[model samples]
Target: MRLWLLLLLLFACPAYASEPAVDTLPPELVRLRDEGRLTVRALWAWKLVPAATATAAMELRAMGLDLIGADRAQLAAWVREAEEGTAAFSPAQREVLSGLLAMMDSGDAAASADMLPADAPAAAALPVPGVVDAVPAAPDTVDTAPPAPDVADAAPPLPDVAEAAPSVPGAASGPAMYRCGAARTGVSDASGPAGPPVELWKLKVGDGPCTPPVVLDGLACFGSVDGHLYAVDVATGALKWKFFAEDWVDQPPAMAGGTVFFGNVVGDRSGDRHFFALDAATGSEKWRFKSLYYGVNSSPAMVDGAICFGAGKHVYSADPQTGDAKWSLETSDTVGTPAVSDGTAFFAHANRLTAVELGADAEKWTFRAGANITTCPAVSDGLVVFGSDDFNIHAVDVQTGVEKWKFGTGLIHHPAAVHDGVVYAVSADNLHALDAATGTEKWKVNMQRAGLKAPVIDGDALILAAGNFLVSLDRASGQERWRFEAGGEITSPALAGGVAYFWSEDGHLYAVR
Candidate 1:
C-alpha cells in the first residue's frame, strides 16, 4: 500500500477498543464538572481550584476534602488509566479524581467549595484578617490622648456630658439603634450644644466599631470587634454590662420591651443566622432566633411587638419575647435594616426599595433605583428617601411606588436623614440638604469624605462621621458647625438625651456634649 493510505488504514477504527462509550466517571465529579457556577479562572483566583492537578490535589487535602493524595506523575497516570479503560472509579473513591477532572474541565465545584457551612468547624479568631484597625491620627488642635481602659472592664463614673440645648419636640424615648432605626434617619429629639462640642469622655472598646450608643433608659448599648455587646452608663461612662458573642458585633443594638436585639458576624459568613435578644436591664441572654439565612448586618427594627431585620436574602420578622420567626419576605437581594411606617415595612436592597405590608406580609410596592441601594430608606409623610450607589438621592411616594424625584449627588453609602420637609444626604464628598418634596438642593457643604452613617439630626445640628472626624453640621444649610477628630475613622454617631456618642475605627467610643 502507498505510505499515506497505509497510515490512514492503520489509524482508522483503532482507538475505540477500550474507551467507555458514555461518561463513566462518578456522578459527583460529572455533576461538578458540568454544573459549577464559577469560571475556572475565578476558582483559581480564589485558590479553591488550582490551575495544575498536583496543586489542586494538595489544596483539596488541605481543605480536608481529599485524603488519599497523588503526585503529578501518579495523577497523570490515573487520568490515562481511566481514559484507556484500564481502571474505573467507584462512587466511594471518586471525589479526588472527580475533583481534579471537574476542575480541569471547568465544572461546577459546588457552593460549599466557596463557602464553608456555619456549623462545619469553629476557627480561631485572630484580628479578623482584611479588617484594618480604624484608629486615625488625632487632629492637631484636639488633645491626642491614649485610649482609656476597656469600657466593659474599667469605665468610671463619668461627669455630666449633657450640654444645654433646645429639646426636640416629641422625641421618642427609645434606644437610637441605627440612630433612630434602620431608615437611618438619625433623627432624635435630643439636641446638642449650640456651640462647638466638648468631649465629655472617651471609652476604649475593642477595634472595628460599627455604630454605637443605642441609649435606652440610662445605659448606652453598642457593639465592638471584641465580640462583646457593651452597655455603658450615659451619664458617667461607667461599665454597666457586656454580653459576649461568637464573633464581631458590628450592628447597633435595638431595644424594645426591656430587651436588646442585636446580630453578630460569625466567621467569614458575614453573620451567623442567630439574632440575639438580651435583657436590657441586665447583660443576660434572653433568647436567640435562628433564621434561614446568615450574615445579619442590618439593625433590627421593633415594629408592633415584633423585631424585623434583614439577613442574607430574606427580611425576617420574629417575636421579640420568644425569638420565634413569625414571617419572612423573600426579597430580590440581601436586605438592609427595615423601616416600619404605617404598617408598611420598607426595605432597601440591591437596586430597589421594596415596601412590604407588616400585617399581611406581602410586597406592597417596589421603587427601582439606578444602582444598588445598601442604605435603608427613611419613610415619613408617605415619602421614602434613600441614597444609592448610583450617586443619587431618591424620594419615592410610598403609597404608589412612583418616584417623586431623584437628586443627583456623589456616591452615597448611607441613608438620607429626612426631617420635617428637608432631606439630608451625606454623599461621598459633600453633605447635601435637599428639599424633600422636589429633590432640589437647598445647600451643599464640602464634607471632604463620604459618611459611613446617616447624619444624626440633633435638633439644628447634623452629626455625621466625615473623613476621620465626627462632624456636626448646620442641618438647614449644611454648614460646618463643629468637628472633632476621633483619631480613627468614625462609623455612625448616635444621639440620645442631649448626649452624642461616637464609634470610631480606632476602637474607641467617645461621648460628646
Candidate 2:
C-alpha cells in the first residue's frame, strides 16, 4: 500500500461497510481492473478515495503547503504511483501533485504527529516499512522471564505510528478460548452485546496479529507475534501484566486456576520452542514444556487436569500446573486445537479426526476424511463434526471415530457450531443448520463471503462477520437479525458480561457493547 493511502485509511472511515457486491463497483474502478492496475490494495484505497484526500490535505497544510482542489484531485494519481500501481490519476489531480512534489523536493516538510504516534505500539493496514525490518529475523535463544510490567489495557486510541509490535463455553461462563475452542459443545449461552456495539476500549500491545483472546479470571489474555502473552483487565482494558515468550506466541492461552497456559511458533531458529504456563494476575512464569522439534500454535485444552495440545509432530498431555508430561502421542503433523469431552481430546490434522483418551495417552480411534480437514471438530450429541477441503462437512461417531454422516458444501474453513443437537456450519457461501444425529439439513442460509473465523452463538443468535459487517442471525430460522458495521473485516468474537470482544487486522483488540 502507498504511504499516503495508509495514512488516509487510518483517518477516514471504511469505504464500504459490507463487502461490495459485483454490481456495485464504480465504472472507473472496473476500468482500472481491466487495465490490470486495480490491485486489491488499490481497489480498497480507491473505495476510500472519496474520504481519504481530506486527511492528506490536512497533514500537508500543517507542513505549510496549501493544497488546492486541483492538487487534491491529482492525489489519486500520486497514490497509485506511491505503491507502483498502474492506475492513472485525473490530469487535474496529477498537476497538483507535481507541484507538491516539487515543493517537497526543497525539503519543505514538517513531521506530522498524526501520521505516526509516539508509542509505536499499534500496527497499520500492513506492517510499517521499518518496524518489522528493525527486529532481528530470529532471536538468539529462548529465555524464561517472569512477571513483566503491566501494559495499560485501556490505552489511548490506536497510536498514530503504524508499527509496534475463542473457546468452549460448556467447559463455562467465558468467551471462546481459541478459534473454535468450544468445538465439543459448539455453543455459548452468554448474551453478547445487547445492541450495535460501541467501542469501549482497545489496548495497543504490538505491531502484529493477536490470537483470539481467552477471557478468564477478570482478565483477557492472548498471545501476540511480538513474543508476549498479554493479560488485560476485562472491564477496563488495562494491561495488567505481560510475559515474554522470546518467540511468536501465536495461539490463545488456556486459563485454569489462575494460571494461563499457551504456546508459540518457533520461527527460523535453532533453539527449541517452549509452551508456557504463566501467572494470570502477574504474568509470572509458572512452568513451561519445551518443544523438541516444532513450535505450538494449537491452543491447549484443559480437561482432567491435563493440558492437551499438538506441537511439532506430537500431541502431548501434560499437567497444567507443573508442565509435567503425562503422555505424548506422535502425530503426522502439527495438530489442530483439541476439543475435550468425556476425558478424551479430539482434534484434526492431515485429513483425519482423531480421538485419544487423555491421561493414559491411549488412542481411541481416527476418522479419515476425503481431503484435508480445515478446522477442529465440533463435538456434540455423541458426534464430532468438522469441515474439509473436500467440500463436505463430516460428522463422526465420538465412540468409534466412524463417519456418521457427511453433508456436501463449498470448501469450509471456520469450525462449525453445534447447539441443541444442530450443527451450524458456516461455509464460504452458506450457513448450514444440520441435524446432529444425522446429516439431514435443517435449514440453510446464504452467507456470501463469510469470514474465516468460527461464529459465536450469542443466546439465540449466531454472530457472524462477512466483509466489515458483524451480522447476527437467528439461530433457529437462519434469518438475519441485525448487522453491525466495524471499521475493518471482523474476525472471531467472544462474549462476556454482554460485551462482544473481537479483533481485526486493523491493529486493536475491540471490546464492544
TM-scores vs. true structure, each candidate: 0.66, 0.66
> Pairing residues by index, what is the TM-score of model 2?
0.66
- Shift in Å, residue 363, candidate 2: 1.7
lDDT of 2 by residue, 1-513 (tens): 699987777568576344553433334434443454443223222222222222233222211122322232344455556346342232323443543433222211122223222332222232322332122223212233222223534353321112212111213333235643544454655667766667777655543456667675567777765566776677766556666676667667877776788877643223358888866656667888888654674788876657788877688888876888888888776576788888788878667778987756467898887766767777777888888767788988889988888999775766788878888887766788898888899999876764535777877888866656677888889888777666665556777778777665555667777
| Minimal lDDT window, size 10, model 1 | 134-143
- Residue-level error in angstroms, candidate 1, position 291: 2.2
**Which stretches in model 1 have alpha-carbon errors above 4 Å?**
1-175, 181-184, 266-272, 450-452
Over the full model, what C-alpha lDDT does candidate 1 score relative to the true structure?
Answer: 0.61
- Model 2, position 458, has a per-residue lDDT of 77
Candidate lDDT values, in order: 0.61, 0.61
